[model samples]
Target: MAATAPKSLGAGEGAGNIGFDRSGIAGESKGLLKVLDTARKVAKSDSSVLITGESGTGKELIARAIHRNSTRRNGPMVIINCGAIPSELLESELFGHEKGAFTGAHRSRTGRFEIADNGSLFLDEIGDMSSDLQVKLLRAIQERKFERVGGTQTIAVDIRVISATNKDLAAAIKEGEFREDLYYRLNVIPIHILPLRERRDDIFPLTDYFQNNLLDRSTDYQIKQFSDQAKQVLTHYEWPGNIRELENMVERISVLVEEVDIQVHDLPECMITPSSHHTSSSVSSVFNNGIGFNEAVDQYQRSLISHALNESGWVKARAAEMLKMNRTTLVEKLKKMHIKPEMETPIF
Candidate 1:
């Protein structure tokens, strides 16, 4: 059953108590807030949940949040990466095996399902689960009971199932790679997390969170401020790796950058340089505008100068250095072009 949308909680609010501990997940963007709200509402239920998102988008983090907020908070939260384990051993990994059930079974082993009893079982990368195993998993999840590998006695357990996957299971089902029935059983409450690029509003907040949080733990690390130009670059670039990439970059800079004021040049070259897609789109717009050649060149110069000036906080000398031009020359051009901060647009 679908849950009604409730008022979204601000990031870091309603924390510490059960069903409200959103300690690690940070972001105030509407997309993220909505997801969190749904997660909170679903946490109170015992229905199965399926979380879908790109890699590094914090699907597991959401799963954990749901578990922490749920009735089973005190129970163990067992997780398994379906894609990481081999198909041959995955069944045993999920359902446990008796001694001598398989060649490697030196002794009877408890699987994730059994270990997760009375708690939450997070099946990560569920899309990658083998077709052969899908049938067994569906039955177990449906009945809340299963026989251990090579064991005749059936074992029963109470668990809340939460599965996450980066792949599109709808297409997988159409292609017969994933079972449709199993998909329905697991997707009772679907929660999709938008990628970082789609929620650009969270970038700076996350940066601040990562920077300050890291500094608290390590004496070697220090908080670094992001320059306006650097912020611009971060805002425009697509974060294919999502929150994980942002956190890593923050830590990397905190360790390596000695300057307290982080300049645009301090950022990774990939972020500073325009991607082929963006470059092509910008160039196409320029050509489509049908402006004269000289005017086009002048506009291009204005964009560059404006970008540099903004990056340098309107300091002529610094902007000139960034542009590899004399301060006098840059000032003269700015006056001639009638450029102002408000008119500045980042072409890259």
Candidate 2:
């Protein structure tokens, strides 16, 4: 069974202020509701917001909602994937430069910040930013001013900064990988996203949504429904890639399976049998005749933890639900197992 919604939602009116229509999103889980609520409340304010979650958890959608709801909705909303750009050219990409600033500088170019004037700038995968660039970003946020690479004049921007990351920034700060001051500055209001596995109640709804909304029209395949057994299999199996994986699986089944209802046989091969679900079991049964009971238990635990972590994109709270444990207990288990809650590489 899926867990309850985050406790933050019931504490005050602010928790209940998520303005977006929950019915429109993929799933009907409490996690989805809470995220929408948090996004709504944060949207009303212009303060910097740092959205943290595993990849494919729809961080960009939340950012877009915030931008659309904010006072700057009429203006443009520029998105810059910090991890996608080369380190050498990031500075120029953020702050425009005059002609001849670099080898390929043919004309005066505008950066994301300048183009996003009177709007919002969304910096995705911000954890991958270099330390030197972090200093420049801090300066810009602190002073609301920045200068192009080769320009003499200072440009003042009236824009809101919204950043998202999939790394454990706190741990990064401890290791001196991320700057402490910069972290605090961007984390003015932090929003955490729950992964899909934690909210099993929303699985059927999400599957239906994908079938109705994302399926290709040209394909002659009719709408498919999940059988009760298939639903149980989905709920029990670990979702490593969160919603994106689920969406992909659904689309794949839609294309390959001819029937209107999806059964256990329609699932991917790895998920069909209980023994094939874990790496150790498949190895042990074939090579060692049978594995030790304790080793099997450990493998099971590891599989559960890994699945939950992947489904929730490594967010601890959501992973905890996927494991059917309390958040604090899950954190303790992670520590004991030496499993880091956050992904090492940036996942935005």
Candidate 3:
């Protein structure tokens, strides 16, 4: 028989919930909205969920949301970064170890499954796991039972599994890198997170949300407006790094551009340049003879400013010092280059 569903499922309460707000998942994209709705419905059931997305697309967050909205919200939610742990150590980490199980096993350990009993176990970057581990994981999921290293007693687990991966598991299976049976077991309920680029509508609201949230923390700047030109530039730039990149950019601009209202000229050079899609030919020609000296310098300056902003975590004064430029001079350059510190809400 299937495991019993936890009471209060879909009510969004408990430690396993991780405070994942439904609003965070809401987006302008119809596809995303549909996905969120489906996720919500699935959360009501006790089914394993497999989230697939690009590296920075917030798969973990979605998993948390699912767990929070699920019946097991009150239980512990354990997260295991499969890629971060070495293959040699992964088995012990997931299955725990008994005293004297192997070298340095002085005491018994409770694995992630045991810790997350009756809750959720998020296996992040599952694509990076080895085939041996995959077989172990598959057996554990099928029987909900595992044995600790060097221990004969069978330990039963009552936890839901949520696995995430950026890599194409089908391709990995074809390449003999991943187990096909494990893939089928994990793919019972699949949810694909749309990248920020695909859901442009969320950009502006997310920017505003981050800005307002930052300001609440007593940031230096009191200004909270973006110029029309600045908005255009932001919308045009192809955000390869997705929402995380956009968030970083907004925080940088918020602290750097001091004006009550940000304008187009306050944008970074990369935003204004026609070459959002920089070709190798363009890069080579632009720097080969050091020709277009002005443009190259502008690019360098923009990069310097961007890097400073990122390094300083979007604090303008710190970024200014890092850039080795006077605060006033930095502000002037920003204006001249049409680099706006404030980004408009992205419309999907």
Return whichever of 2 and 3 wins on TM-score: 2
Decoy 3 TM-score against native: 0.72
Displacement of the residue 17 alpha carbon in candidate 1, Å: 11
Ranking of models by TM-score: 1, 2, 3
**Model 3 lDDT tens row, 176-256:** 999989999999999988776566666786676666553333434464577665665565455667777777777777667
- Candidate 1: tens digits of C-alpha lDDT, residues 215-255: 43445444677766577667656777899999988887876
Comparing 1 and 3 on lDDT, the stronger one = 1
User: 18-109, model 2: which lDDT tens digit per residue?
Assistant: 45433335555667677777777777788999999888777887898788878888999999999999978999999988999889999989
Two-way TM-score contest, 1 vs 2, winner? 1
1 versus 2: better lDDT goes to: 1
Off by over 4 Å in 3: 1-23, 214-216, 219-223, 268-348
Q: List per-prediction Cα lDDT, in the order shown.
A: 0.82, 0.74, 0.73
Tell me which residue pairs clash in candidate 2. Answer: 18-37, 195-312
